[model samples]
Target chain A: MTGYIEKKHTFRSWVIEKLFMGKTIKEYLKGLITPFNFVAALILLVGVPVSVYRFTQGIGPSTNLSDNNPWGLWIGFDVLAGVALAAGGFVMGTAVYLFGLKEYHPTVRPAVLTGFLGYFFVVVGLCFDLGRPWRLPYPMFVSVGVTSVLLLVGWHVALYLATQFVEFCPALFEWLGLKNFRKWVIKLTVGATIFGAILSTLHQSALGALFLLTPGKLHPLWYSSFLPVFFLISAIVAGISMVIFESMLSHRVFGNRINHQGVDFDKLTLGLGKAAAIGLFAYFALKWVGVAHDNRWDLLNTPLGHWFLVEVFIFVFFPCLLFTWAVRKSNAALVRFASIITVIGIIINRINVAIVGLNWNLEDRYFPHWMEFAVTITIITVGVLTFRWIVNRMPVLYEHPEYKEIDQ
Target chain B: MEISRRKFLKSISAASGASLVSKSQFAHGAERFTGWPERFGILTDITRCVGCRSCEAACNEINKLPAPKIPFEDQSVFEKIRRTDAQIYTVVNRYPNPKPGGPAVYVKKQCMHCDEPACASACLVKAFKKTQEGPVIYNKDVCIGCRYCMTACPFYVPAYEYDEPFKPEVKKCTMCFERISKDGIPACVEACPMEAMTFGKRSDLIRVARKRVIEQPDIYIDHIYGEHEIGGTSWLYISGVPFEKIGFRMDLGTTPYAELTKGFLGAVPLVLILWPAFLIGVYMFTRRRQEMVETEAENFEIEEDQQ
Candidate 1:
């Protein structure tokens, strides 16, 4: 209202205009009750109650995690996979603000938003899984396990979540029409971005470092001294692929706003696909080197070895080739397909390290109980709803009119 | 998604540039960690063991843990291999004897209480500690029941009390800490009628184990099991049969499990220090490039106005 010539609206009118999309509240709720939203609603309806049950009854009743298998779906998907997927913030922040890639400027905000929401929801999932999650900050404040890799993860994630929030504060400021706060936050962006990158580097690798102590338990195929490096490299692949996958979905779902914003989705997809191809290729090569270094050649004859090969060939190498082909041919459809594969491949890798490859010789392998899946689905649903709610009104999908042409 | 070959090339360079910037430590590392000097430990001779469950009973009674389903005198319980669980800190597992028509050799299984315990290193809150007294003890008050110790332990000694819904703590043998700290023997050692186990300084015990092997090389397999396994566990065993044949993991090399993450953890400070400088340097470099482009555009516009 102050920066633009438009008049200010009362709170009720503003809500009606922005949230209700100038339609009646009844109409807005009717529009929201689509098949997808109905499914999302059902998931949360069952899942939230299951989460409550977990807190009261403990993980024994809710999860299939045993002493033989201490971690299950929640830790693997929510913490490990969630953190890896959220690497987009650091990747895009560096590309746009640090590396002088001005063309990717349109993606930086959304990438950071995606990263912020991903991490926020990861913490939500951790609360459900952690026994006595209220003591989560004990590692940071109360006591210290200086030798542990998990302490590193705990501290880094907490600090990085704050750093990512600060990095995205400019969007929140603009959405709120706080001119001075927005300007100050824009100035803080570079420092916040740098700190976010630093935090990401430590924790991303630290996640893999967590499994280093479980030498014989985690299958030798996935276990190597190179675990931290492999995790870091593959997280880059996850970040790039997720940005592609996310933008594809967001552009289609928020069609009119994206069209109005003039985001060239095709160009961004090809550019991200090219970068992912190179990153995935180097990571693929790293995996082979890891196998050779560990001298696990004979392991390939076994079933576990064949499973490892499937992960490498079909998921890792296949996507690498497809992305390369997609980039070379400028085939957006193939690029999109490869992006999905790359996303799934990253999830597979995290699951491999966290669960499947772990305790490989156990007589009874652990599986996630239905309650565990329900809680996980609930967290994702809430995260998506939050993302949609914010993106609808914030300057994330569209540039702030007053702040236009101000390069971040 | 539009990119000229130049920007595409720039991004290829960027991808490499990003990889170069992270600078991960992925080197293979294997190092032995001999624990504290003068730490008390156990030296058990497997040949003297008669599959007696006296040690198991002593451990359970000393720890005040719940009673086992089968009494300690019930030898039928040993028919199948058993693992130490929440209520039972130690178990006697029967293995095939080296000679024909002989009593199966029994290996007393409990926490190896490794010199550098992986569980202690893995706990996020310092809930577990390798005490100078030679036992790896856990703090019930500090434990958040993450159960990571169970996962990191190569021996799988730490068993979680999953049934304890309110506050669960890992259950494992504490090496009879209460008794040992008082200059008294562990309950198991006291309970052994055959005197199969010896308790003394770990260094002295190792020498004693070595002497037994040297004196009776034929009877002793010539290798002190825990004296070398995983950088020498507290509970040493000199067995007449090969250790592996008696459920011991001969595959566990002398390298301590804690050494596995040494290189990775060593690089933590390096990342914390190097990353911010790298990030800021890139930011300044990019900002300068943007300014240069803008200045050049302004100059061209001025030149056009003059024309």
Candidate 2:
């Protein structure tokens, strides 16, 4: 009886230690009252009800979507921009596991966690946009539209989310102190990485292919047969820049948890900047190639044409030059700054394609309703909170001492 | 000279049975589908229309839609050109006639129902289908209400019940599928006192449109509107004025919209096949290179220790 009691006591202590950061309930509650948490709570308080109201009220009342514009902010920012930013997982996974660049292995766990959460929230955002959210799995199980580009996107996103979870399983297991499970998951890493790459390549491009059927609806300057290629190459840029951008933020926010371990983080940032420069240049060339292929030179002087030029020149070309200069000068701060701009540029590009350039000739244009913004902000807040919670507890920023050698 | 009818029939059946058995699967590996051979179509003669809203009323009644705010006979509704909406599946818009001081041209607008439907290609859940009959029908039971069909449609035909929170559906012209399937003409066609619309097999409709255009060159344009637009639609049109002037887009090419995504979708399986093999190859190569470097470093360290 005494032995069983002692075991129960130890288990309780373990839970308090692991879950509460070795603090008493009162102490943990006090620690949670930080400025960040207060703001997050306030946002959620208002945002959560707005999302509920959306389910009760219907999309028309909550959003500016009309017959002319079916897709809006949820698809533009939440799904497209979210998916692009989350490309860091496949990028880092391929670098560490497939190409055997072990130095980048540290960023893999956080990247995968961010990616997994990002995709999870994308589905959540899609639920808000879909009229029947419960039937999301119908495409996979009930009726499959094999010829559709969206079916490819649906299947790939679902499969890739699972793959990312598997890839990040080691960190999760290590956090839980499950020795045997962590060992088994580590063995599956390379296989999962390869599968992630395959899935990522198809879905990222398939998102672009969704617009191919709207050649007449989308503006001539933005529409092209090479949309899929442009999307894929730019996604690669988004991935690399996102890794740099995320690491910069993570090192600042979670600085105490990360052990430097003599790793040259600045060197890694510059290396990523170099790859991003290459991707941006290729994307820039392809943008003009698309223009020339369509022979839409006359359109370059119109107002919408001017906007397209701004997107191509300021966003794509300028970022290419900035990344190149930053890499050549070995300026890590500049690289980080360039990454911030690149991330914003990717968001702009997605929004332009999904909203601005679509139905350009229409008289009634669509702008997101405030309720739509609230729902979007709510989703992002929840995602960030989830990311923070996992990062704080899991073996993401630092290696667990018990299995340090076994992790690799 | 003494051949019996039964002997001849037996030989003919033996020779043709193999081909007849495979006719249902005739679409397999065909270079292009020319739609269902005997599919029906509607050919509208624009000159014959007199801006009558009877067809609209008939469509509404047959579809069991909510009553319009303005009565069907109210001619004031033509002041503003309108589109199909959640409650309204078809609309009639009045455009300025090409000839100055002439009467306005009233065009009936609804779903074009392309031979290779863009909605069918865009739907992730296969909610929409091109039926063997003329109508491109929708199955609401399987619909997830993504509204991608609204975006994919060239004519901007499909509308969503945005007001219905729980049971939203994509609303569009069914071409009176229930009536057509039961061997009855559409309510709109039956309601038209002007006989402006003709319903028949798609091929016969094309022939009728061609004969009208050739017979009345001065009165009709030298084109059949939907005959070759986006790989031919079930709804054909013959107009006296230029199609562009009456709100029809002439820029839509003859290629089926489904062909646009074919290359990308085709590459999906190719990636699934090739990407893993390539990644594995690279993984093996990198692992071998790393192993070689470690061994070389170990050999050097051993020699130094001996020294």
Best-performing candidate as measured by lDDT: 2
Worst 10 residues of 1 chain A by lDDT: A1-10
For candidate 2, lDDT tens digit of each residue in B1-307?
8878999998889879967886786466757787988788999999999988899999999999999998999999999989999888888889999899988899999999889999998999898999999799999998998888888998899999887899999999998889889999988989999999998898999999899999999999899999899999999999999999999988889999999998888787789888988999999999999999999999999999999
DockQ, candidate no. 2 = 0.81
Task: State which candidate has the highest DockQ.
Answer: 2
Runs off by more than 4 Å, candidate 2: A1-8, B1-17, B20-30
Q: Per-prediction count of colliding residue pairs?
A: 4, 0
- lDDT (Cα, 0-100) at A229 in candidate 1: 87
Task: Estimate, for each residue in B1-307, the C-alpha lDDT of model 1 and write its tens digit.
Answer: 8899999999999999998887657633753446787788998888898988899988988888888899888889978888878888899989888688867898888898889988988988999988898999999877776777888888878887766667877899998888889988999989988899999899999899888889988788888888878777899888888777888777778778778888888888888888887777877887888889999999999999999
Q: Pick the candidate with the highest TM-score.
A: 2
Error of 2 at A117 (Å): 0.8
Q: List the residue pairs that clash in candidate 2.
A: none
Error at B87, model 2, angstroms: 0.7
